[model samples]
Target: MASAFIGSSVKTTKGPSVAGTLAETVAAVSRWGNQPSSEDVEEMIRDSALARHAALVKYLENKLAQAKGKLKKVEKALAKVQENLEPTELPTDLETISDEERFLFRKIGLSMKPYLFLGRRGVFDGTIENMHLHWKYRELVKLIVKRKNIAQVKHIAISLEAESGGVLVSVDKTTQGYAIIVYRGKNYMCPQALRPGNLLTRRQALARSVELQRYEALKHHITDLQERIELVTSELEEMEAGKKFEVHKALYSKFDDGSIPNEDEEGEEEPFSEVEDPKSEEGKLEGQSMIPADCNLRYQAL
Candidate 1:
């Protein structure tokens, strides 16, 4: 069966490009020293750039952690589902009821309200328990099965009788849906534990198997995205650090090489002040190119 939360699952496949955002912030600051600037202004620009980069990195780290948490949860659930799909020893002997007894029980069941409803997850352990509970008070247990054809309903009826130790009385059509009437035989004895080692039929297991495949794909995809994001974030940090070191080296080398006069020689040094920042026309284009077009919509959906 397909996942019920298809819309949400679709969004999870592709999330925000957080690494791209960090790269944009780094690129914006990389152009800082292209023009001559004072030390204080340079320091302020560096601080702003670093702060933004750190924030983006933190956000991506948190996102990665959340994806991992979800993957863990999915894996745990998948394990249980796989266990249910395994083959196990089931009761082979079944109690038989006469035609007269089946007709009488079917009449009784038709007039009574349904005790339980069965959907895609058919013939689980809980259904058997509930059937026993209803049988404790009455001879017949009525079940309504929906969204299934005649063959599937017949399969469910057979599985129910085998698992619950009840006699299959009749499978009838009613206004609500396909109705299954089960008669607890004259020699009925409730088991101490109704929970079976494995209760799902082949069809039910197939449905669950499909759902497991979807989650498996999703887990792997999230892991891939996390790796890519971390790689990009690391590269952005390295570029920022290297750019800052280069700027510092260039400024200090000018003083050491006697290019800028000292205070003793020039009588006084030029007062430190911010310079006129150049227009960064390429920054917008660079950021736009770094982020995927569909990432924003997917992130919002998430």
Candidate 2:
């Protein structure tokens, strides 16, 4: 807001002199047809005074206006300095560069922020929760959990430039129900799976390290798939229990009271109607049937 009283102050102060001169000229005006009188001479003096006063005022206004403009420029510069003196909060898209990180960036002659690599747009879309973590590392952790199908981070650690081409290392956290996944890159080696001790050559070590990392990374997924296979196998077993498993009836000590039913036994046998008589009383099932070839004959449920 520029001041409302800059050149106007000069105009106000010098305005009275101009008005006074004009008033004297008006008072000195002669009555009709009186040009040669003393009134005319007084009028001329008054007009000259008015012109000089007006010029003085014009000069003052120009000088004052120029001074006012300079003052405004000075005021703006001072305000910017004051603003710089006040502390500024960190921007949302940027993390505070630590002294060590600053040193590293200076060494490399590259200025990069950790948040620049975290691309978090549309991650939680259609999710029931509307919240997001505040920091980049936390967001990266969240991304890992979301992609790895896990709920919470079990543990997190960082090593500067831990990966082969990595510049820095970090982790993040997020919301959802997912399993945990750990990725250690090619630097991790397994003593039990691989040969004991380090590799024989640098090339062999690098290749073996990448291979081991791949296997280790896929190990959990393979286990999860195997679990799903077992689930499906159990379901199939349950569904086929009656049609295909009736052959185990003979191993069950079921006699149907030993009174043979009216079904013909001379023709093709009924697989579920002819079990051996029970030795133990309580393990008998309701009907008799042929024993399964794979049945364990020694164990009885009762």
Error of 1 at 202 (Å): 16
| lDDT string, candidate 2, 1-302, tens digits | 24766655664454445556866666667434345667676555544543433443344344345435544654554344333122222222322345464343333221111211111111111110111121212222111222242111222111111111122222323222121111222233322322112112333333333433334433543454344445434533443353333223322213222322221431233232322322221121222211222212221110
Query: Highest TM-score, which number?
Result: 1
Clashing pairs in 1: none
- What digit string (tens of lDDT, one per residue) describes model 1 on residues 1-302? 36777755775447657566977777877966465569878776566555544655565566557657766876777676666543332354555566566657667776775467775466676788889899889999988776446766766676776667677777766556667777888998888886666666555555565556556665775676576567546645765776544445433322132432222542332343433332222111111111121111111100
The C-alpha lDDT values of all candidates are 0.60, 0.29
Candidate 1's TM-score reads 0.40
Each candidate's number of clashing pairs is 0, 12
TM-score of 2: 0.18
The stretch of ten residues in a row with the least summed lDDT in candidate 1 is 293-302
TM-score of each: 0.40, 0.18
